[model samples]
Target chain A: MPQTASRPMKVSYQDLFWIFFKAGMAFGGGLGILAVLEEELVTRFKVVSREDFLTYYGISRIVPSGSMTALAVAFGYRLGGFWGTIIALTAMVVPAFAITVLLTMFYQVLKNTNLLPWLEVSVLPAALALILAAAIKLGKDVFRPSAGFLLAAGAFAAVSFFKWNPALVLLAGGLLGIILFRSSQGEAK
Target chain B: MSLLSFILLIFTFNLLTFGNGPAMIPMLQADLVDHAQVLSIEQLLYAFAIARVTPGQANVYVASIGYFLFGLSGAFLATLAIQLPGYIMLPFMRTYERMRSNAWVGRFTRGLTVASVGLIFAATFSIGIKTLGEPVTWIVFIVTLLTIVLLKWNQMLGLLLASLLGILLKLLL
Candidate 1:
């Protein structure tokens, strides 16, 4: 029972935008966006409590999209109404968007020079490492020792080997989960 | 490419995406590189590199793509399209709370989560095959893997160091 869910917290749109915008620019990155927000809002500024952040984050994960943006929306709805949702989301997005665009523009300038190629090619392996890290982290969360391993392996094979549509593979996994991993086990599965 | 189809593509990816930015990479790669022929793998990976240099999620890296294809308007539209899913889903979440605890939903989410992880693994395999051939890349790769994954350091630091290493490796052996 987090305090956030029970008692409403008031955050001005100006505060929401500036807080999230600065958080965006801060690049407080060890984990996903939600963790970064927890750091910026809860840990740093004391805007929200730790318990509240985790509570919203948990609910956001359980939601269908499961993206960190969902958590942004959750915070928005909690802190303000529909407009708050828009402003908060915009704050989170604008920095990343602006920087990406500016860099791409700079990339055009770098094109006439020699650094562009190294910058592009040399960075892939590093980027790939990050992607691999993400996979390993997410993999550890979703699969158990034995039974869940098979499900993950099966999904991987379907996508990489068989060239099945990822959407279809996900749909099939959902169907199988309903059929196979029911609540009948009694304990948390 | 038609702007409408491009928007549809962004929307489709967002709708199906279950995790964060990295998890969505393979699906975006499939469409952009293999299916729709919007970008070559190298070009897409370049956008990815530049994207990593920035702060935050860097969601679709479509600004570069949209700019490449259709200029500024395309960039704006693509950014909006990528964001649309989160906004669209927000109202439903606010209005309805029962969807949160349904056991059937729970089962569905478990399946989805596991499969999303698998897709990410497949993505890593595919990208690793194409990249990771050079010594510079190998050094960058190992260092990034150790720092970001093992040490739990911010990816921004890994990327910044990688860029510096790229320059150093170019000047040296």
Candidate 2:
């Protein structure tokens, strides 16, 4: 078992490395995979509650880096310090990197074929579905009767309809969250 | 092109983009389409399509395109350039945890999440409009959505079914 820390639990280096490595291989793209990590590692392992995971997910998105990679780094650091962060991040990326390289080579040889195009067009809609499902799953916490849903919807409209820049939209939502959700107690619950 | 210049360009493009791998599409298109004598527009589009279907970072798909254009060395150079920023920055992410309770930061993130969701929605809408333009495609989209959403089917399985449907439609109709 990992040691208990005041805030984030202390995790073994081996556990941290494997957790992230498995996560990267299983989950593709940082965003979608982060959600799965939250569910499996955080919630299931009792490392954090759903609420805490949601909060972390929110922060990861707010930051300027890849959400999945950021989460892995943060989770690792929380559990095992600087070295943990390195292990986690590397583990998360390496598997995907290797797989991608192989796929790229295979694609190069088959570039002239009709089958690849057929496969792509066929899979595009499904990819969209997977992403949408991920969004729904992640957004469930904010789905209740509150300003969160409206904020999400508003942000969606701004980008989807008005073509507003994402960074700007994020800024607006953050400001609104501060004003609307702020409390002196500093408790999300 | 020199490996250094190639790496620099890939890194620069990765930094400027917002969305992961897919966001690099337009930038790659701009760089490779008119300027790079290596690839055609059709080839680039095909590369994009392949990248989307494959799991992992969209950047990897771009790397695949690079490999196609300039062989194995080009692939390594491009992938390294794109991934370098994330690898270098990973170690430092711990420092930001201290600011978890900062009101301003919290507010900022909340806003960013909202914006990201919006961007996601927009992306979904745009793709949906373009790909689901035809009635048959629309049917496939709706059916797939229902299967995944309502039936709660496995994502990969749903994708496989949809792909089969698409190929079958193409073959029969």
Candidate 3:
């Protein structure tokens, strides 16, 4: 990895707010945020270099909490330091929070009425299917006909069949991966 | 559940889990639903749907739960609980990078990432068995899965189509 030790461009709090606010509103999911951030932060404004941004993103994935939020923190710190971190994170988070709460209110209105069950019947399967698709995609991406496959499959069985707590499964899987899949490179393949 | 406990629960999970949005779903469900009983599985499914349809982090779904349970204040609390600890730890981003290439950390992260998929699948299966009863739901499920896997459609668009199909099915049948 090429480490660029250059000073960051000075971005105003308002500028950071609107930039990430736009990103927050435009992108719909965690992965999509990367593209939008690249466009706005790297290609468009040149706030952060592609290498640094990607580095932050990689770190974000390894740490706990939401990946996007983690990105916001790192990117924000890169842009403006501690206060920048706060503003950038707020910008990124507030839009989604507002939207979710609005929808929750809508759900509340519909919850007590006869319409709630109907909404559930229609939405739940699609949501489940999306998740199932994600699982399949992840398996295809991760499994290489080795111990990785076995670990993933075993984790699945533990969680699905045995009703094991996911946190515990994840902990055990990490330990197993350490013991079994050592000497491997990172997740990038 | 008390507001403080809710915040503590989300904060604790955020501090611990190594993976991203979908991975947190199962843990959140296990805590808020199975353990706390603050949210029913059905309500949790609806919250998951709302999170799916909306923008930003999927943990916004947990904030939605807080909103549902206690209104705007609850939403703020929950979002803060989940987000603040991670943000505060932003200074440690460099620290994580230092340990990034460590053998054990790499193995742990790989394992955690792979297992997260299974945990997400577990969540999906649990919800699927309970919610996907109607034939129309099955149709939506199949169609959405095919649209995503075969067509390589965008996820937000896929979710929109699924939501519309759900509404249409409810209207038609």
Candidate 4:
């Protein structure tokens, strides 16, 4: 809700390339890049307004799954054209993914290890708890003395007991929301 | 699964894998676990756990599945599959913004969020069937749930405590 207004600055593709290349020439790596990006992207080059960044960020956060990559693509498209999309995406993804791949690789290597069962045994219950907690929290927030309860219960039964495809169920929920919630708001008005 | 099917599967599911990381469980479980038998619920949960602990957002679970099934190229492909939705949906961002203030859009989003939560609840049932195999794990789960929902413990800490409790209970009993 707090808005930070950003003024966009004029910088060419050549300026962008020099910022990256000469920053490497001058400021050094890892720690210095943050400063460069803050100076250039935030204060100097100023590609996206803060509102634009936050709006895209909010969209990425609210939606499921690929928040990070989504933001990368969004920002990339804003900063450059098609090639900018590729470079920004790669820059954002590659290093962080080392962390993602490393543990999974270990999971593969440790599959037959005597320690894995112990790891699995410990992790299983924790995973279940996490899932249940999210359900309880969201349910508490979403459900009220209304059709919301019916929708929630319907969705639960469809997926859990009746074995409906969750994607279809989600589409159904959206349609119902349009019909159900819209009419209720209409009545209140 | 064929490589193409795998790509299609990830792409389709990521579109609906809304709300949060945990909301993803039932959808992933529905196809990948129950139908295809590609991975067990436990393995999937482990991957979920790893994704939670690691950097980035929820996409890592897809990456893990890809890596588990078909190695590095699979990981790359899965990453692309998951990322595709964001790209496809990008142009509509302005349309979404225009619709944001409409009463119908709010209701639509509410419907989506409520159903996503419902999916998470269903996940608790389906996953609980496989996960709560022993009394200790059940106890660990319940205590962890209480600590999270009631005592207001943070998710990461609660999970860490629950896993540690599981290991401790295993050693003791």
Candidate 5:
């Protein structure tokens, strides 16, 4: 059985905001943001044990929204109730929001200049590379040797080649998984 | 667009989105860029790149697009719209946890996870078709792929190097 902490840990809203805000400013993406949050909330502050932190993190992934923000809200609620949830989420998003607005504003100033075209067009390779990397990483995780491979390939072809709507493709995949994994023999994983 | 319309549009998108930012990209492109003509492909990709290079969630890129379409207020509204409905739904996850032990829910969850991987791939394919053509671009793309995917380098470092390579390629070749 998992051991629970002896007493409840006290966490201030300011700490939640600053930790997540710093995470927002420093990390590159969702997974990175989650990692930073774990470091601060679990390892450093001991506000939540590693197990609870991970449980909330897992919940964040299965939910519909952005995983990082969801985790922030979950963790906040865990520690400080409704207001904490609101404060943590706001803190997590604000830095990203501010930077995005600033970047776009700079883009407006630069768009008319020659440098703008050069930067935009030239960055295509980098952008595409990053996208491909993400796909490959996610693909490896979801694709098993045989059954998963077929599902992933089908989903890829359906969307990329036939240009089927992605939402439909996902539903089909889910339905197929339900059928395939329904059998006892298919429960190997 | 008016703030109400902007909020409605993004809220609709966020409500349907499952796998976060990457999954949201293709839908946003089709609706905002192709159908609505709110922004051009170049601008969309530009915002994507900015989101990539910056710290935090890639969804922030949507705010940039909102800024392009309707200035500062649009940006704020767009961010709120993309997040609010979805955030509201998070509290319901407690209920979901109880239902998760049901057979169908478990299967559906697994399916969504697997399908999300494919969705990410499809999103990349759609974007790559437009961006990758030139020989130098292919070279840069391959190098980046090998470094990041194969060797497992830090993403931020990889992006910075790729950006420099982009500049150098533009200047020289």
Candidate 6:
């Protein structure tokens, strides 16, 4: 693991606010904002290397919450302790939340009009496209040529074809991973 | 359902739907139709359609539907419920960071990633089947998929183009 020799700089609350606020501004959804965040924090600030950031990003998704939010929390804690976490999470979420609320309100008022449904029909394909793009990107990372691809395929089949409970499938996959990847030294392979 | 029940339901729904806003749809439909009787199947479908076309989480559609059915209070409760889990859990995410170095946890996350991918793929198939039922719809779906995969077009652009094609086909053919 590459570590910066100098102590972590003291990032003020305002700096924290701006960092996350910029992230929120650039936020397009999926890995897009993360790309911007990597450029700004990892590349510009030298906070962490690209490999370290990607590793964190990948691991963050597997945890039990929103990956972006989890990343914000992690980044904050890493830079500034508890207060850093608070500032980072707030900066990341507040702008987006406000925008979502305004958009939702506007949508509610305009929802019954004749044009809205037409607009919806128009945009639906894009949503599908976005999903496909995200899936492909994630697949590139996780779908190594090994058994990982088979595991992903099995998961897709179970959910799409059989409509099995997602939670159960996830649990089973995790257990399978442990059994398959555990090393002779009892470490995860 | 009563306001309290509605709020509780929404909150619980958010808590369990872990991936993103769209993941909440099937669960929301189950709760709304089977348990709460808050929405009909048609209304549920409409809500989902609206969610996709909009820029935010599909869960936000719950607010509009709630407001339409029950009024301002319903909207407030619905919105609060949807956001509560993420908001409440934000503070404790720090504690979660402490455990990241654990090897077992790493393996667990690796497994979970595979599962998450599976879940998203399943969602894609299910949504695709229902939304793209007609021959023309299938054509539009294929075209859009190819555009994204081949042309490397921005997804928003592909969606806009596909939607226009959909409407044009509906109007002309």
What 10-residue stretch in candidate 5 chain B is worst by lDDT? B85-94
Query: Candidate 1 versus the native: TM-score?
Result: 0.61
How well is each residue in A1-189 modelled by candidate 3, as lDDT tens digits?
112235546678788887778667643366445545755687668877543454455445556657678788777776777887888778888888998888788885755545446656555566556556544544454557777778778877998898886557777877887788656454322
Q: What would the per-residue lDDT of candidate 4 be over residues A1-189, giving only the tens digit for each residue? A: 111113242655556555443222211111122223333454456664432432354355445445545555555555555565566555544543565567778885744445444644575576566656544543564557778778878988999989997667877876787777766442211
For residues B1-173, could you state the per-residue lDDT of candidate 2 as single tens digits? 56566667777877777336777778877876777655687777776765555555555665666676667777767766654454333433333345556666656555555545555566556756655554456555666678878997865577678868877787787
Query: What is the full ranking by lDDT, best candidate first?
Result: 3, 5, 1, 2, 4, 6
Candidate 4 clash figure, as a count = 0
Taking every candidate in turn, the Cα RMSD to the unseen true structure, in Å, is 7.2, 4.7, 7.3, 11.1, 6.9, 6.5
Task: Output the worst ten-in-a-row residue range by lDDT, candidate 3 chain B.
Answer: B14-23
> Where is model 4 more than 4 Å wrong at Cα?
A1-111, A114-116, A182-189, B1-82
What lDDT score is found at residue A105 in candidate 2? 69
Number of the predicted model whose DockQ against the real structure is largest? 3
Tens-place lDDT per residue, model 2, A10-129, is 456887777777666542355446534654565456676554455555555555555565576667766776787778767766765666567656665765665444643566555556
Comparison by DockQ, 1 against 5, better one: 5
Between 2 and 5, whose DockQ is larger? Answer: 5
Which structure among the candidates has the greatest lDDT? Answer: 3
TM-score of each: 0.61, 0.73, 0.59, 0.55, 0.62, 0.61
Better of 2 and 6 by TM-score: 2
DockQ of 4: 0.27
Worst 10 residues of 5 chain A by lDDT: A1-10
Model 6 chain A, TM-score vs. native: 0.56
User: Which regions in candidate 2 have their CA more than 4 angstroms from the true location?
Assistant: A1-109, A116-123, A183-189, B19-46, B68-70, B87-96, B102-127, B130-173
TM-score between candidate 4 and the true structure: 0.55
Candidate 3 Cα misplacement greater than 4 A, ranges: A1-96, A99-111, A182-189, B1-82, B88-93
Error of 6 at A188 (Å): 8.6
